[model samples]
Target chain A: MSEAKFSVSFAGPLVTLQDAGRPGNMRYGVAASGPMDRLAFDAAHAALGNPTGGTAIEVSLGGVILNCTSGAVTVAVTGGDFVVEHGGQKRASWTVLAVSEGERLTIRAGRAGSWAYLAFAGDIVAQPWLGSHATHAPAGFGGGAVLSGHSIEVKNTALREDRLGDIPQPEFIPDGPIRVVTGPQDRYFAEGAVERFLSSPYAVTDAFDRMGMRLDGPELDLKAALSIPSEPIARGSVQVSGDGVPTVLLSDHQTTGGYPKIATVISCDIDRLAQLRAKDKLRFAAVSPEQAVATCRSYLETKQAYLDQISIARGTLEQRLMRENLISGWSEGDERAAT
Target chain B: MPGHAPKFDAIADHAVLVSFADTISDEAHAQVIALDQALAKNPPQGFVEAVPALVNLLVSFDVMATDHAVVIMHLKALLDALEVNSVSGHEREVLVCYDTELGPDLDAVASATGLSVDAVINAHLSGDYRVLMYGFAPGYAYLSGVANEIQVPRKTKPVRDVPAGSVIIAGPQCLVTTLTMPTGWSIIGQSPTRILTGDPDAPFLFDVGDKVTFSRINRATYERMKDGTHHV
Candidate 1:
């Protein structure tokens, strides 16, 4: 057996191993416990050319600290604009990091965003439950979260020396309101409740976790006090509890719920919803199923294109201006002129 | 039943929900089970998983491999050709220790039903239960076939912590708790068997439409069984 390479020195409130998550086991009463921000997670993997099923550390608010126990290794830090420090030198996120043996790497909380991700070049050595290494915290499955004393091992420890170029700005900036499709149980609410849900702004509450997050917004009065027979629920399901607060379900959400659902967030916007911290303003916009599907298809296409282009050199700021090729007589094909 | 079709709609961008009926009924439950069985027997392309609930089936598909439109089309065709009445589920026996010590609500249940404690136990044991769905927790089975005479509303104040293997009942439904969780249903018995083993080969013991019958066991047997590690 390979000796552990990384020892967790500090873990915030919750830090767990996450991958794409187990997809087909929802019928077995297991939730798909994947990364909260899938776009960021996939971007990190794409940044490193890592294969699927490579487990990444999901560092929550306050971030995490790790000490390299053995040989040097290459790692990538992405998501949520978290501050990455390598050997007491501040480094930008979305860039490759190198840590030598006995060096400490700390990820401190960022001003914006609630979660961050640290991914190694290869798969993390952890047992898979239901075909996923992602931790489902509520049920105490998937080995729960990584504690301060936990030692993590990667399959390939050989270090890659070069640092990948960093993007100037973080990815996945929310441009508009969260989009939703009116639901399987929209009829259960009283008249105009859905309109109120759409018009009024909701704020993320402190009562939040991987399972779901409660939103403080206008009351969504229900016609009946009783609950319908428990039915299947998906991530992004906007279920109004008995108290009338809307809760957007997330990873590790229950398979079935008795509460009534007014709408469901489209798949493309769920990652945007995951990054919102407490007190962040959130609004919903209604979209037809067809529109949502088309939007998702386009988003997937763009994501693939982005991953394909990651290997190309982004060039420095001056070179980027020249490459725009807008100005006349600025430069020719000469490498020196372009530089 | 012939000529019955489910209402198909999008619950998420990658998921489609098939509602067999608006209200929960035996026929709707049977259709849910039937659709699940048929899909399991002949799963379509890009099919991820199907979650069968009281009267609805939520089918998730890989958006990368297949679109929502394709999955909905295939599900509609499957519904048109499915034979719900022909699917037979597995039968299994469960032992419950219904002694008053383990079942704290025995007297209350008896008083509410206007029957003696022995009569309540006999009524509970007489009816053959069907697994309607699995929810709330792993291996937590939602069952039907509770005797109408003994059916009652859930407790106003739910218990804070009920141990695993606690047999609970509310209205016309019965549940065997697979994990220690808070519940509003009345605990009427205890089972020593572990329903969730986390085993890949057999993660759960019951499937939708499976037949279940409960038999009474003495306190000593319950204690012995609890002490010894038991699996379903």
Candidate 2:
């Protein structure tokens, strides 16, 4: 089979292969361990014109260095702020580049964000456990983490001509307090506790991982018992432990939990939450389910618009920006009409 | 037991939590299973998957295709027409070795229950358990109906590196460890049955509504059976 191979010159802790993740397996006690930033992961694949659900090397804050050893393949790096260098020259994050044999790509932690993604234009050569290449490190499933000295292979590589050119980098805007839908177990919390949770600011603690993010904030007192009958846990569930500390569940969270959840963060904000590093301060705001749905739709539409703009824009980066402005204007009008 | 009216609450924009009752019971479990089966047979437009738990079912959908309001509305219609028939679940027999060599907490559990070690083993074997849910870890099946005589609280501090196939109990629930991890439950025995096969098509041996019973096995049999099948 035709394939391209690369050796992992170096890799940081928690770096593993991730795709769209293994969904529909939570009932069997498996967590969907996709990239923490879904939008960025999709963007990388979009740049390479790779089909959705292609596996990408998820890099943590510790960073990763890869050397292409054989054949040629197109690669794109996206998600969170990170410094990327290709061959002997510096390359911009979120840009597509072609890699041939004997070339090296290095990525390191930048000023912000905790995770980055390096996606290939071909299918990653790995044995998929439970129909996914995504690794659930906590459970030691899906082939484990990619460490230094490991070699990766990709087959069915896409031609470089089919990939998109450099696109305009969108400015990151900090959305206000993360939005949440007050809970499936909200009754377990006292009224005052709910108020305190919404009003107070919480700092992301050092005890953060793919499973959950522990926040140091007001201790949310519960009206009911600390532990309830184990129930299926959703991503972004803000569950209070016996110590009164609140932990926001992430993509790699367990399928079920015994702790009562006070609220669930809206899907649109999960990527923003995932990017937050230690000592990052944030607040929670409760919104109606309908409003949350509207926010999710808006976020998705914006993402799609971005992908559409880049794929069609040809000539230069400035030309892409000019076309992107026009598309945004049209989308704004479309949104108004729909409303 | 009196039947509980199901309550539907929006957990997120893409998910709805349907609670059959405030507490765990056979009636609630039946309702949860019934709804789960119904959804699987005829899923709504954007239905992704339904996860059945002890007394609740979590219905997740694709946000772009459908929202929580529409999904919940469909679920309500399904619930209204749903006939709470007794779900015929698969009955499984699990073999366990109750020797203290594999069961580190066997003596402690017997003392905590104020029963002889043999009586404790008998109490565990006599349990008519049901698979309540799978959680805490991959393929860690939480079985309900732990006998009251042998019921005990979870350990205050969790023990580290509990091995797979460990049959553990705590507060009316029992579980077969599917992975080597930390746990707060009391390990009363070890099972040779392979519950988690790691197969994509059929990974778990027990579904949420399956019935389970325990049988005693010798250490030699446990060793023989363990090597023949995949553990996790």
Candidate 3:
């Protein structure tokens, strides 16, 4: 086996290797433990003009530092906001940068988002369990979280021709309350509970993790006792605990739950909900399943546009832009004037 | 059987849950099992897996590969044309050691049912149980057909760490756990079955519709089976 590409010097409190995750493992009581921000994870590769598919390091709350041990590797950082520095020089995230051997890259937490994805050109070397490399940290399965002093290997791949591209960032933060759809057990809630849920604003609490997020808000009262005859649950389920607090299940939620769920967050907005930090205000808006599906399609289309816009060609932006004859007066011979 | 009008609703962008009944019962489980088996036989395009629970079936699909409406339409047709009477559920014999050492709550369970310890054990052994669903944890099977005479309510205070393979019953269900999770159920016996192997290709040794018959065994037998030197 070839030597590891880089050595981790500081992996924050919680970091894990993740891919799209194993979806069909629910029968064995496994949750789909993919990235908290799916679009951000995809953007990590899209920004780099790399095809999506590989285990990326998901850094939570950020503060990860890595030293390039051997071999130069191209890296892209996306999702949330983070201050990224390579060789003591500040570098913008959501764009590709090369980390040369003996160099260092440090990532510090930003004020905006909760999760960030650092994807490399080659797939991360790890054993796949249940057909997934997505780390299920709670269960201690799959590629567990990154720790300090650990070395990670990146499989060899042909170097890409593209050096830089305009990072396709989300143009605008989506406005309005997070959208949700009434669930199979919506009827179990009291008459006005669903309305109360929609009208009231909930605060994201510190009691949050990959498994779920507990939101403190108006108590969504049930028509009867809260327990159901244990049924299957999916990510984004708004399960009300006996304490009357509503918890939105995330990527690593349990396969099944007995708590009555009033509504499920629409799929397109799950990433938005995941980015909400503690003390952030949250509201809910109800939509039909069909509307939710349509919204998902639109979001997917926007992502595709990002991939299509990637202009793959060459050296740094300065080098390529100067070398190309896109401008009438700009040419390689006019490099002095361009400078 | 015709009284059941299964309801299907979207749970997420890629998953829909089909409920056979609002309450748990043999009929509801039957419909759940039938739908699970039928879907397995002719799994629709973009189908991932159908997780059958007490009264509902959670079906997941690839939203990119297929539309949500298309899946709902196919599920509706499957329910309408489904023949649930011929489900071939497998039968497996489970050996248990109901001694005081392993079954710490045996006395409590026996007294709660107002029966001698041996009588409680015998009644439990005589149960004609079927795997109702797997939930709560990996390879943890919720079973139906707990003997009515031995049925007991969950403990007022749950035990912190019930060992894996601890055979327990709560309300009307028996659960064989592959995890050492906490529970409020009364522990009446201990089994020597490795329900969860953690291997993806061979994850669980049981399924939703498997018939289970518990047979009483001694500590020595339990130890041997637990060690994988003998099969019960």
lDDT tens digits, residue span B1-232, model 2: 2376678889878899999888767788889988888788789998888888888999999888998878888988888778768466899888899989999898998899899999999999988898888888788888988999999999999999999899999988999988898999998889888788656577788998899999999999998988887754
Better of 2 and 3 by TM-score: 2
* Structure candidate 3, residue pairs in collision: none
Name the runs in model 1 displaced over 4 angstroms: A1-3, A163-174, A225-227, A311-339, B1-5, B99-104, B107-120, B216-232
The collision pairs in model 2 are none
Q: How close is candidate 2 to the true structure, as a TM-score?
A: 0.92
Which scores higher on lDDT, 1 or 2? Answer: 2
lDDT of 1 by residue, A1-339 (tens): 333388888888778889888777676577888899887787777666676446898888867889988867678888777888887789757777667788999987777777778888666888877667888876656746888888888876544443355632323244699999988798899999999999999999988888888999899998876658788989899999888889999988888878989999998898879889999998999998878888777677665555544534445556755766765421222222122
lDDT of 3 by residue, B1-232 (tens): 4646788888657778999888877788888888888898888899988888888999888767776778888888888888888887888888899989888878987888789999888888888888887766656788888899888888788888787888989877898766677899988778887676554577677778999999889999888878872221
Instruction: Identify the superior model by DockQ, candidate 1 or candidate 2.
Output: 2
Tens-place lDDT per residue, model 3, A237-311, is: 999877667999998888888888989987778888898899999899998877887777666766555455443
- Model 2 residue runs over 4 Å out of place are A159-165, A170-174, A224-227, A312-339
The TM-score-based order of candidates, best leading, equals 2, 1, 3
Candidate 2 global lDDT: 0.84
DockQ of 2: 0.74
**How does each model score on lDDT?**
0.80, 0.84, 0.79
Question: Which candidate would rank higher by DockQ, 2 or 3?
Answer: 2
DockQ of each: 0.55, 0.74, 0.51
Task: Name the weakest run of 10 consecutive residues (lDDT summed) in model 1 chain B.
Answer: B1-10
Structural similarity of chain A in candidate 1, as TM-score: 0.89
TM-score of each: 0.89, 0.92, 0.88
